[model samples]
Target: MGKFDDLPETRRKGLEKMEEVYGFDMSDGEGDFFRYTADHLFADIWNRPGLSNRDRRLFLIGMLVGQRANDVLGIQVPAALKNGELDEDALRELVILACHYDGWPNGSRMNAVVEDAIGKAKRAAGS
Candidate 1:
């Protein structure tokens, strides 16, 4: 059976949505981990109890910042915007916070990905 054969339609769509935000597309042929991460990361881990989606996005952004994962943080900027948990201001704050912990090198280009996100947001908001 395919890795995603057992997933619900909504769950599959969530992964597809996130993948699109991440500049990826999916296929049953992708790989077990890819399918699994899509289901778990977007549909499971992101949908679990307690926190709102925005709250979760914030935490995720902060986690990337703390770990010096500027690249992931950059991609996440658009994802967070899609999830409605962030705006340019919030993303900038996350990068600023990272500078104190992870240093400026990573924090610097953080805006590159984030800028893309901001531009997308502006486009989406019709600014």
Candidate 2:
């Protein structure tokens, strides 16, 4: 059997959820960080029923901006766009609102990241 065949149910669900959330395959991830990320973050946290994926993405975007987590935003912004969690206009508006609350420096950085992600997505889609 392959490595994933015997994974605990949570881990398997996490892997599936991670792919859905990130718009990419997550089956090859390794190490403890990857395990916890897939198992706990994705499976338990993201899959929680109260919030829709788009709602979660909006909250996460604000949190990332507040924390000035540009690198993670690079990953998340594109994934949000790709997964239809947020469109380019909505992302731009989100940055505007986030900037007011999180400050311009972080918002500025996030704005650039969001624009870049949108550009890349548009190009990839041949739009």
Tell me the alpha-carbon RMSD of every candidate.
4.7, 2.3
- Candidate 2 lDDT over 19-120, as tens digits, reads 889998777478999888988999899999999988998888888888888999898899999998888889999889888988888888989999999889
Query: Candidate 1 — number of clashing residue pairs?
Result: 0
Tens digit per residue, CA lDDT, model 1, 89-113? 8777877877777778877767677
Model 1 C-alpha RMSD to native: 4.7
Quote the positional error of residue 49 for candidate 2 in Å.
Answer: 1.2
Per candidate, the number of residue pairs that clash is 0, 0
- List the lowest-lDDT window of 10 residues for candidate 1: 20-29
State in Å the error of residue 125, model 1: 5.4
Reference-based lDDT, each prediction: 0.70, 0.88
Candidate 1 overall Cα lDDT vs. reference? 0.70
Query: What lDDT does candidate 1 reach at residue 97?
Result: 76
TM-score, structure 1 vs. true: 0.66
